[model samples]
Target: MSAAPSRPVCILGLGLIGGSLLRRLSDTGGPAFGYNRSAGTVEAAVADGYDASTDLSAVLERARNDDAIVVLATPFTALEPMITSVRDLAPDCLLTDVVSVKEQVSDLVRRLHPRARYVGGHPMTGTTESGWPATDPALFEGAMWMVATHDDTVADDWLDVAGIALAAGSYVVPAADDAHDRAAAAISHNPHLTAAVTATVGAGESDLALRLAAGSFRDGTRVAGTAPDLQRAMLEANSVALLNTLSETIDRLITARDALREHGDVAVIVDDGHRARRKYERIAGSPPEPITGVRIGDARWQEELRRQAHLARVWMG
Candidate 1:
């Protein structure tokens, strides 16, 4: 693993992602603490020997004093209030987020806390679970964590965020905000919607059908078990990209349905899907690419990093 971030971290939200991040940082001896809106969650985290509290002002104050990297791990709908507090209390702190959609979050940061050095991030890993109780310290292990790079992004701020991701055992993929959202919509958001549809159709069938459901059904519908509110928040925040991707998916499905009805064959969709799945498997099973160093303050560093990411390369701290 790369070196832990030099600055302390203050996570503003103690749900699954935030809690797991706190746990992983603590396990790695990184200086980190968290804040949660729920008193119950705060109490549980405190009881478990974590530095957590329900006082938003105090957490942001500490972040300001220590110049900590403040991670906003709240849901999409909850970001405004949290960013408001960060703006009020920690205006100059290095801010980053683990929110699923990057463009929206980056826009919010620019609008609400423009003085803060903000680097948008999204870790491409999770389970069909929610809240502090479902937190797993190793949830991000070997996962792809995206760090957003734009023309105005501060190189050192990006490095700090990437360092945290690397310390958590994740490979850093540097991408622009819009590109991240569009790609995530195709892979993550669209899959969740399809999973929900598949699960609903399966459940609508007879009891015997559900009883006979095995590995394929279970695997396909696994993400459908995520909290509805959470899924809705994420999906709705990336609506434009999700809509485009879903339209493409619907068209493909319609083509398959028509082929099956008219010619009794679905080779077009089936063969394409098989090839895509195999490509994914091949990439997933392949060894990691060698780390390439990029001069952080170079004029074209952002472009270099994005180029490396497009080629499936990672940057280590």
Candidate 2:
């Protein structure tokens, strides 16, 4: 693959993701610039020795003809318009976004800027925090970086993006836009919605009972603390996948309930739940092997699953 060009990089959002990327790029000698809608955020980022501004044109102008611009902070509602604006302002620049959902945004990018070089990205890393103030240089360390690409993304440029993830202390993974969104729905987006529901139900109970809640409650509901708008964006962006996962989860819960009702003891259901959770835990921290098939139910899947289980055992020991 060709080396990443020497063109300066511009980030179009200066919130947590944008701010964090700016800091990482600065530390790593990576070309980095930023733009944000909020003057306060832009000023803060600039004051922190990052080249950030509130002017969209100014940021775009800073990017070279072939440079990459990473859209970091815009919400889903604003994304289409922003891409439209960016196309007008930086038509020749290669573009990428840190949006949580890929398929929708990738489709939008293709529709809006057919000539523009673009790839969809989800860093799969963030904290239960918001704003430029919450940005940390190390936030992406050891994170999973999903690059959603298609036939359009130039092979050389795709590798450059992958290299950025590696240099930023992340593992690179490739997935088609739909696959990326569905997997994220199962693991990231759906979990947040469930957490919100769990927390909401728990909070609706008597104040005395809530006061008596423990670590398990806090742990289970931690993702609920994420900004409501962010969570809404994720769910809305991948509604189909999220809904499917939700249905499956509901079915599983009903099955467990039926099992408990049928037998005096729920040992079988409990054992199944425990085993499933353990299997999940094993895969959680490890990189999955490239999905070699449409249905990951074959020997390769079993091998990767067993490898993860062994790693989990070693870590536990």
Candidate 3:
């Protein structure tokens, strides 16, 4: 049997996050492959001159090597099944994900794929849009990409996954799985939930609120229009962490309401919010420390999978 090819980066979904990574790889360097459940999505990628496949075997064939990395960009709902599907086929490969919920995925990867090097990742970027057509290769540029890992994971395993994130222009941020999830709950998950509720309330009894809604209303509820399934999956996946954050947000809302009803000072709440907003804007402008060593976008994605699968078949035979 021939030796398996190495360094292949296989993306196992062609949604916004996955497609964006594929585009970035094409520009920056490819041995990058994309797979989507929808054959049409895979064909669309092929038309764009990407290495893509609809078949699981074909996708795995591209990742069947020691140095290969498979990035699962599927919804958190599909993450466990996808992890289970590929666990034994590519034992030595470094398998990671671009899901929002880290603790669950990190825990599952640890339990199900002990032989595979797993790093849970969340790229902190997206619009209210969804799917391949809405994808931008530069989406991750200047964005924070959080990676979650446990103590048992080695340094190289973390670096291998971080490489894919940085090569696409992300600012690499590392955290423990539970910590990452907790932070995500406060910063991302709760905000999205609040946006949805805001939108719902603003829809109002007479539909007048929505009709009269201006930029302030539009801006506030922007994320409420995000793909519902995506929102549901992520919000549900991180419910434990999010519940605490939601309670805090509700408390603040009640405090603001009380100040209005009780004729107490509401300006203080406004001042605090303004201060927080300014701090956020300032932090957004500041650059993070650059991460080194993620330059692996130069290989043909599927060839690596093909070679590995052939090697596997021959060895088994």
Candidate 4:
């Protein structure tokens, strides 16, 4: 991977994801540049000691060539226009995005930039926050960063996306564009909508319920507070897959409701949920028993160690 002298990493949007990437890029001894559409936001990033610009032309001027990597951290809706802008203004940079959906983006990149080196990416990590101010440098740490590409995407292009993710403290997962969308719909998209609904229900409840809202309620519906525009964009952009997931979710909910009403065994549902939560905790919180290679950049010690532990536990017993 190239450092500052090779090709700089340019982030096109300074949202939470983009800003967080910029923060990590700075530590890589690379020339990291940031650009946000809003002047005020750009100024804020600049004040934080990043090379940021509100002017697209300036960002393009500083970063132009195949060596450069331009990460489009914009929303899915803004992707096309940003790609078109890059096409007309800047030299071909390795194009990538941090958008949640992948299949639609993969198709769009293939159609719009026929020969462009593009890979679709989504880091499955974020808070219910927005903008640069909400960015945390360690946000991607231990998160699963999924990367997708068309059939023709080159090895180097894919690695570049994965490398960036790794640098941002994530483990990489590769998938086909369609597979990414379908899986993401079930895990990320629909679940968020469910969380929002849960939150809404709580909000509409009596004051007593509001006061009684505890860990389970708060934890389950935490994502409901996510930036409204961003959440809507993610759900709408991947509506086909999301709708399918939603239908499945609805069916499951109905089954649970029926079980409760008919005096059917509800322990099965509760047990499943309890087991799933434990599995989730093991994945997210268990980062290998003892993290080694603390100073190594290329060795994925943390992820590898934890994965080995998991495999041992599953296979040995």
Q: Write down the TM-score of every candidate.
A: 0.98, 0.85, 0.86, 0.85
C-alpha lDDT score of every prediction, in listed order: 0.91, 0.72, 0.74, 0.75
Worst 10 residues of 3 by lDDT: 308-317
- lDDT for model 3: 0.74
- Residue 170 of model 3 has an lDDT of 68
Off by over 4 Å in 1: 291-293
Q: Flag the better candidate by TM-score, 2 or 3.
A: 3
Write down the lDDT that model 4 would get.
0.75
Off by over 4 Å in 4: 1-6, 149-151, 288-317
What is residue 65's positional error in candidate 3, in angstroms? 3.9
Best-first order by lDDT: 1, 4, 3, 2
| Candidate with the larger lDDT of 3 and 4 | 4
Candidate 1 vs candidate 2: the lDDT winner is 1
The clash numbers for all candidates, in the given order, read 0, 0, 8, 0
lDDT (tens digit, per residue) of candidate 3 on 26-138: 66654688788898888888888888888887678668853568898998888776887788566667778999988788777878886666777889899889888898987
Residue 282 of model 3 has an lDDT of 78
Compute the lDDT for candidate 2.
0.72
lDDT of 2 by residue, 14-44 (tens): 7788788778877777677788899999888
Q: Pick by TM-score: which candidate is best?
A: 1
Badly placed stretches (over 4 Å) of model 3 are: 1-6, 289-317
Best by lDDT: 1
In model 1, the Cα lDDT at residue 78 comes to 97
